[model samples]
Structure formats: C-alpha cells, structure tokens
Target: MGHAICEELEAHGENFIVIDKNESRTETLRDEKFDASVGDISHKDLIEKISMPPTIFVVSSDILANISFTERVRKQYPNVTIFARAADESTKEELVKKGANHVILSQEIVSNVVYDKIKKLEDSADAQKLLRVLKETEEKLAIIVHDNPDPDALASALALKYIGNGVNVESDILYGRGIGHQENRSFVNLLDIELKKIEDTDLNRYNKYAFIDTVPDANNSASVTPNIIIDHHEVTESIPDADFVLIDANCGSTAAIMTKFIRELNVDIPKEIASALLYGIRSDTQDFTRNTSPADLTAAAYLYPHVNYELLKQITSSVISVGTLNVLGDAIKNRKMRGSYLLSNVGFIRDSDTLSQAADYLLRLEGVTTAVVYGIIEDSGIYISARTKDIRVSMGEVLKEAFKDVGSAGGHNGMAAAQIPLGIFDSVKDKDSLIYLCEEAVTKRFLAVVGAEDEK
Candidate 1:
C-alpha cells in the first residue's frame, strides 16, 4: 500500500521524502527511484536530517504513526499539505483536527470504489451523466494537454476525443509543443494523432474543454477551466473546479483511467487509440518499471488485444530524426560532472522534449547520479530538465530553490524542470549566452541543494 502511493507521487512529478518507522516497511521501494528515509518523522533529530522540505506529507504507514507523523511534519512545514490514511470518519476528523489537510479514510475509499463499481452494475447513471455532457450539440470540446505534452498527455487527449466524439460532441486534441522524440513522433504518426500548439487554439470557441493528464497550475500551457479532468499523480489540494475529476493516484498513467472511461462507454477501442494509450502507459511508467499500477495492468490487459504489436515493434526501431540528434550531441559535448552529478548544456533546441530526453540520456551514464540538462529555445526562453539517480537529492526542491528568483520550476523527486525567459532572442546565435547561463544556474542550484559552495 505504501509503495503504491510512493509510485504514484513519483509518476506525477511530485518529489517526497518517505519516512518509515520500521526500515523493512520501505524495503519494497529500496533501490527504486525516490527519496526514502528509514527512521521517525516525529523524531526531531531525524526531521532535521531531511534536506528537502516535503510538500506533501503522506502518512499511510499506520494509524498512530499517521496522526503523530503527519502532525510533526506539518508543524515543521506549515505550508505542506498533509494526507493521512484513516480507519474511519472519526479517524479522519481526528487527523484533520491534528493538522492534516487531507484525510483519506481507507474504509471510505473501499466504499466509494465499490459504490462506483456497483453503479455500473445497478444502473447506467454514470454513463448517462457523461453522455449528457457529450450530447450537448452546441458545445465544442477541446482536449488539452500541458506544455510539451508527453505520452501520458497525448494518450489522455486522444482517449478523451474518442469518448467526447462518440457521445455526439465535437472534439479535437491539442498540445502546446511539437512531438520531436523518436518514439513520440512514431506513435503520433502511426496513430494519426493530430497535435497542435495550445497558443494557436481558441479555448473560448469551445465552451467545454478537458485537461488531460495534467493539473492547470502545475503547467501553464493548459491554463483553462476544464469540464473534465483526468490525471494519475499525487493529489494536490488546489485542483481546479471541474465538472468531474478522475484523478486516481493508484493508476500508473492517466491514459489508464481514460482507457477505462472509454471502455465503460462500450465503444470499440480503435487500433490507433489502443496503440497510443499503451505506448503512453509504457513511456510514463518507464515500461512499467517505475510506477506501474494495478489499474494500469488491468487497462493494458484490455487494450493489448486491440493494439497492433507489429506497429509497436516497428516504432521501437524507428530512427531518431537529424534535428534531435544534433541537439542531443551538443548536450553530451557540454556535459560536466561534479561528484555524483552531471550537468549538460544543449545551447539551443526546438522543443522541451529534446532537453528532457537529453537529461534522461545523460543520467544513464554510470557515474551520473544526478543529471541536469539545459537549452535555449529561441524567443520562448531557457528550458532546463533535471533527472537524478540520487534517491536523496530531490530534483524538485533543487530546481524550485534554484529558479525561485528566476522562474517557475518544480516536480517530483527524481524529475523536475525550470524555465527563465530571455530579454532578447533576435538571432539564433543569441541563445548561446542564455544556454550557458542556464547551465551555470543549475550548478548554483545544486550548490544550494547539497550545501554552500566553498573554495576547492
């Protein structure tokens, strides 16, 4: 149960330092990607040892630990949102009284899941509710994804389009960035998925919009009131008001939730959609290695028969485009190592996806425990992508502190991103200085995270 929650947080880009009283409780997550400490969160000495202040305090270990540990962490990190597991409503009340911001009753969750499943059995009310929303002939629905939409974002957008259109609504899937990754481009092309920049889109033309696989405040690209929201990340308190929110932290990918939502409508899972959704789950969950959920497995099982295994095989072998390779090469050439960390600069790139891939590629090196990739993107700004094998160093905290004065940047423990706008980008070459500054800024941020820099 504990590992499942940690996996969800990791998947959704929320970094956390997990504390377990019994060291063995975190054994399942050992050697896995995350910042997990074995000790007592309530212990003052142990709390002081924490390098990154937790944003979400999860107390899913035990009832007593839940109350004591959550209160302790919440008191230390006053702004942190507390999520505690409870046995009953009374327990929830007690947790809330003790300072938990969000109290999740274990029994209530079971009841709700059973209730939803039973609603499926008893009557088709759930279907009718969405069908009513979908049958609004005057409404146009645009399924939007956040900046530089990833596989999860793409898959969620597609799944939403299928359902919204099936129920008689006009829908189109939109993205804020170009699909440049080899696997992403192949998946998009093979699926015939049409993606467009969100800036060029008129959200006002469509009264109904759905945010797929992302939170609005989390990424400004999909900044709109969503009629429907679907995501599979750690729960955030400030989720925007939506007609419906299908955020199952237990699921590995939002695509899994979207696929199930579509399946309930009894529509045929198109070959293209199934393929895209499967790829989304595979990519977001790191081929089910990082954060595979039971729901993800169930949805994959349903989609497997409909997917084109042949196409998937072909996609795997698809060659990387020349443009991506150029940027990737530059990133590697500029790679610099500092102890367990490796920082690289890709002077300029066309998209954030390339920067992220560069970071991922760099982190694969044996000596690199933390990898930060930066690049300049014309007039848009400087983009930074950081990934880490260091389970202790929260990349989210590092980026947040590093870019706190410069720009916005925060995410899960292992992966995070930051961007700072440039005053001018009149020519392509002007990006060189910004890229260098971005790289240097990341280094400074690392120094802040580990400790103050000293003359070496």
Candidate 2:
C-alpha cells in the first residue's frame, strides 16, 4: 500500500521522499529514480539527521513501529502533519492521541474499495438499462428540461443527449421558457450547446422523450410522458410512469448522477460536457455550501482535470442584466421585516430568475435568517424564491405548505421556489390593486406557514 501510494504521488509529479529499513526496497526505489533513504524511522538519531517536510506519511505494516515513528515525529516537529496507517481501531485511536493528524485503517480502506466496486457494478447496470431504452427509440429522442433551465438542468440534459448519441440515437435538447438567467445564458453560449425551444420545435417528430432534473408533474412545460426520468429533487408526489427512473434526493444535483453514469459507462467526457457538469454541481450546491453530498464532491473531482476553467469562469462571471438590477432594486426597496424574516415584492418582472438572485442577496443582510422574494411575470403567474440560513426551517417544506393548493413548490432545505397561476387576478385591470392583492396573499400565507404571522 505504501509503494502504491508512492507510485500515485510520483504519477502526479509530486515531490516526495521514501524511507525504509529494507536496503533492497530502498535500492529498488532509488533505481526507479525516487528519492529514498534506508533508515530506522523510529530512531531519534536517524530522524534528527534528515530534513522533515511539512507533511509526512507513516505506512509501515508493523503497528508498533508505525506508532513509535509517529510519536517520535510528533515530538520532534509538533506542527508537522502526520498521516499514519493503522491496522485496527485501537491503533488508530492511539495514533491520534500521539498527535497523528490523520490515521487510515487497513480494514476501512479495504471496505471502501469493496463498496466502490459494488457501486460501480450497480451504476453499470443502470447505465445499460438507460442505453436499452434509448436504443428502443425508433426516431430521435427529445430530452426535456424544466422551464427556464438552470445550470444543473441544462448540464444533465446535455449529458443525456451525449449518451443518446453514443447509442446512435439522435436527440434534441428542448426547454420550455426562455433561459432568462444571465449566467445560464452565458453557459449555453460559451459551451455552444444546442437547445431548441419546445414551442418552436415539433415534439411529434420525436419517438421517445426523456426528462432531466425535473419530472412531468413539476413546473416543466412538456405534456408528454417521459420514457426516462432523472432528478435529484425529493419526490413529493407519485412519479409519472416512466421506463427508467433515477431519482436520488441524496444527490445535491442531477448533474452528479449523470457524472456517475458517464464514469461507470467509461464514456470519454468532452471538455465542454465536463466543464458544464462541474459548473452545474457547483451552482446547484451553492459551491458545496448547501445540500451537498459525497457524490457531488466526487463528481466535481472527477471532472476537475477535464474541465475548461476559462469557459467556466466566463459562464459564472456573466454580466447582470438590466432586468435583474431592476428586480434587485425593487426587492431592496420593498423589503418588509418580520423579526429576522425578510420578504420583498418585486411587483412585476419580465424575467422570473431575478427573484432567486434577489432572495439570495437579501439573505446576506445582517440578522436576517430567512429571505423571500416574489414577482409577477405578467401572463404566466407569480414566482417566489426563498433562501434561509436557519437550520430549523426547511425552506422547501415551508413553501410547499404555504402554496400547496395554489401552486407548485419544493426545493432543498436552504433554497426553494414556487409558481402560482394568475387565476382570477389575471382579469384584474387595475395594476396597483392586483399587486396589492398578490402581496397580501403571498406574505400572509408565507408568514403563517413559518409561524411568524404574529411577529412584528
């Protein structure tokens, strides 16, 4: 294991030195062009003679010897990071008490390896099922994303399209509403990703349909039943019938699941696809600060080497549009505080994505534990975006209970969104009265659900 670790470090062009009591092993490492020395690692005289690096690894099979070496190193260099290997739990605890920064157990490492192999087999099976479904497509497959697709939705759609192409099946990436988010638009433009507006495209031409990052009952505009459904959202309702379903609420984003499929299937990820998936994971997880899972981080690490950093930078640093600025201004001006809760009404907006931006911004205010921003989208309806730093409140559940009968709403614990149809308010000719009614209803319901209705 120690030699294997050394090989990995060497493969990554990392500077490392190898020490062993076996002269033959030291000679072999030296012959392989490694910096090596034969010495008793526990001996104080030998340890004092060599220059110690900021980090050291002790991986000898002898548990007593490893413990002795770790204690000696810790006493000599108190601040140095010691990564030591232990054979069991007792040894690990003892090593930690001896000032080892990290201790890896042999049994734990073996168990992890076994678990990964089993997981890979399971992923491979799932990938094959998806391929079979794609192969059954007589004509082109239509990959549908939610309305006004975010980075996670867009990237997952792209990955499915890539998979479809691998099976010699033509696919078109379809979306409902316009991609109004500036950063999302930049992502599509920079990656040269091809997407067709569902309204403009002839949906009848496709023989099969697949939904990514969303389900049919969600806010998506597609009416057709999907053949394949992949999403990371918590399943709040009965999923529509589908040939293949991969819904893992544990994942931070659907992009992470897609990344796993790409890896297990051994598909060579294109630089554009890699970059998109990486950004998608980062965006949906709020840079791994919210609703993140081990799978999400693993996916990001897998794509890091293949990602196009320049394109990712351009996508994230997109210029905020005038509409977004106006919405932000309105949100700030109209913000109402109820204790630590902040709610804002942006009145009417051409782009609903700005609500989320406003909500995110408002959550940064001092002493504010939660922020909710809402805006009307003329003909569509009223859109609400919420953010919360309070762990006691699950924003998704709050929004769902607040608007259960009136609209569709659900999201992670930290962030959530909702859309309510205009209904009778669509006929209101007076704009001010309409805005007042909407504000009153939204604010009251939200506050009531969060148990802040009585708070001033």
TM-scores for every predicted model: 0.68, 0.75
Clashes of 1: 4
Q: Name the regions of candidate 2 deviating beyond 4 angstroms.
A: 1-114
Off by over 4 Å in 1: 1-132, 135-137, 220-223, 235-237, 423-432, 450-456
Candidate 2, 102: how far from true, in Å?
32
For candidate 2, give the lDDT of residue 448: 95
> lDDT tens digits, residues 4-88, model 2?
7677667545578998999999999999999999988767687878899867778888888889889988998875767788998
Candidate 2 colliding pairs = none
Model 2's TM-score against the true structure: 0.75
Assess each prediction's global lDDT (C-alpha) against the native.
Answer: 0.72, 0.88
Tens-digit lDDT track for model 1 on 1-456?
Answer: 556666665655555677777776566556685666677655667657776452454555468767887777767776554567788888788889878766766645443343334334322434445666667637788877777777778888888787777767878887775677788777778777887677898777888877777766555576677777777765434787877666667677888877777777788888878988898888877888756877788888899999988888877778877887887899889887777677787776787788887888888988778788888777688788888767777676777777776676756667778777664333435445655666666677666676644412
**Least accurate 10 contiguous residues by lDDT in model 2:** 110-119
- Predicted model with the maximum lDDT: 2
